[model samples]
Target: MLYQITADGLVLFHLSFILFVLFGGLLVLKWRHLVWWHPPAALWGMAVEFFHLPCPLTDWENHLRHRAGQAGYDGGFIEHYVWPIIYPAGLTPGIQLGLGCVVLLINVLVYLRLWKWRRTD
Candidate 1:
């Protein structure tokens, strides 16, 4: 029972993190503290994609599923839950590199804005 509860919490946190990465900038616009958070979160998101690494959350989910005698997916959560909606097929290295570039570019822009804002003040 304890393990199940912990697994459920992990799943919830994982889902929320996904949402935050996608919509975080919008949230940052309202809460400036969140702006400070954007770069690291963005980096982590891109790293996961670029490296083709399984997120710890996914591992945790799989472990829980296994414990419950449920089947765990072969691919990452993005491949299982998100790929069908966004990506037509399996993810590739080129796509991963592009995703990483996108993350880096966004952080560059954010830092530029932060510098400019600081200079103006």
Candidate 2:
């Protein structure tokens, strides 16, 4: 029971972190106070994907899953989750690079909008 709870918690954590990467910059746009953290965190998130590093959350989740006697996936979490969203077939280098670009571009656009809004106001 404890292992099941822990595994579910870890899965939620992984999913939330993905959300943070995808829309966190918009949060910064809406709340200026979040600006200090969003760019760095978003960049760090992108970098982790670009370099194919296993996130600590992924590691923790895998550990929890292992404890639950489940076999965890081998690739990074994005490859396991986001790839299905972005591509119908399995991931290709072009798709992977595009995903990275999309993440970076989203944050850049969010920051630019914030900058423009700040200047106009």
Best by TM-score: 2
- Model 1 clashing residue pairs (backbone): none
Give the per-residue lDDT digits (tens) of candidate 1, residues 1-121. 6667776777788878876765566566557798778767877888887787778889988898778667778777777777789969887778777866776676666567766766897
User: Lowest-lDDT window of 10 residues in candidate 2?
Assistant: 87-96
Stretches > 4 Å off in candidate 2: 85-88
- Kindly list the per-residue Cα lDDT of model 2 for residues 3-103, writing each as its tens digit: 76897887777788778887998888778788787777788778776776568877777787788888777666777776679766776666666777888
How much lDDT does candidate 2 score? 0.78
Error of 2 at 28 (Å): 1.2
Residue 80, model 1: Cα distance from true site in angstroms: 1.1
TM per candidate: 0.73, 0.85
Candidate 1, position 60, lDDT = 84
